[model samples]
Target chain A: DTAVSQTPKYLVTQMGNDKSIKCEQNLGHDTMYWYKQDSKKFLKIMFSYNNKELIINETVPNRFSPKSPDKAHLNLHINSLELGDSAVYFCASSPKIVGVQYFGPGTRLTVT
Target chain B: AQSVTQPDIHITVSEGASLELRCNYSYGATPYLFWYVQSPGQGLQLLLKYFSGDTLVQGIKGFEAEFKRSQSSFNLRKPSVHWSDAAEYFCAVGARLNRDDKIIFGKGTRLHILP
Candidate 1:
């Protein structure tokens, strides 16, 4: 069983289009996060939701929005996707203690 | 502000040889350290973590790391390198304010395996 799962393992779209990535965790974790991995393999946290409440919001562009339907699900919606947005988007979850984060198979987005 | 640094951008090691990856962090308190490995086209997998107690922590894939508070460093080491171990390794630190605080990741180090 996958502890953390994400949809759309790969996404290819034209610039200026909007897309969304969904993530879920079955480990009963209360905290979910969104991270972006650029071509240089730098993983940076974009946003975090704790118990369905927005907690940490990095200096990411406003086009990226995170929505948490419940504690187990967090979805990221990006508007007016730019060429720079073509990166691997990863979703992760952690217990309240924030020990080791469980990551899902990243979604590789390509902007044309 | 807290941050993690992985000095070596890339490292190469022959198969069966020992490997070491250095990591340093800047934080005000006793920081929580972690090591994660990411294979090509895959997400990051936790290799090990150091919360407290023993300064040494063992992890999967025959990897281990030592937390040196005085040095403000947590270096990962493996007795022998495997070809499959050639991937990107990241060092992360957890925020101490909130247990669920976000994790700050380093730029990551790419390991090259020489067979």
Candidate 2:
């Protein structure tokens, strides 16, 4: 059983297009996060949600938004996507008591 | 802000050789440090974490990490290297907040194993 899973393992779109990546965790975790791994393989936090509430929002552009409907799900929506948006996105979940997070397989987004 | 740093960008080790990956963090208080490994086209997998108590913590796959408060470092080490161990390793610092917690990760160290 996969603890964390993300939809659209790969995404390819043109500039100015809008897309959404869905994430779900079956680990019964209270906190979920979204991360972006750039071409240089640098992983950076984008957003974090606890119990469906936005908690940590990094210095990301407004074009990128994360929405969590519940504790088990978090979705990322990007608007006006540009070529620079090309990267791998990973979703992770962790329990409140223990901060250890389990990550999803990741979604590779390529914007041309 | 809390952050983790990986000094080495890449490292090469021969099979059966010992290996160590360096990691450092900056925080005001005792930080929750972790080491995560990422195989090609796979998600990051937790190797070990240092929350409290003993400085040395053992993890899966014969991996271990020692947390040094004075140095503010958590270095991952293995007795012997396996070709299958080649992967990207990330060091992270988990910061607890009033409402939620967040983990800041390092750029990552790529390990290459030789036959």
lDDT by residue (B1-100, candidate 1, tens digit) is 6799999999999999999999999999988899999999899999999988999999999999999989999999999999999999999998668644
| Docking quality (DockQ) of candidate 1 | 0.68
- DockQ comparisons of all candidates to the true complex: 0.68, 0.67
Clashing pairs in 2: none
Q: TM-score of B chain for each model?
A: 0.96, 0.97
Candidates' C-alpha lDDT? 0.93, 0.92
Summarize candidate 1's per-residue lDDT along A4-112 as a digit string, tens digits: 9999999999999999999999999988999999989988889888899988898999999999999999999999999999999999998864567999999999999
lDDT of 2 by residue, B25-94 (tens): 9999998899999999999999998889999999999999999999999999999999999999999998
Point out where model 1 deviates above 4 Å: B98-100
In model 1 chain A, which range of ten residues has the least summed lDDT?
A93-102
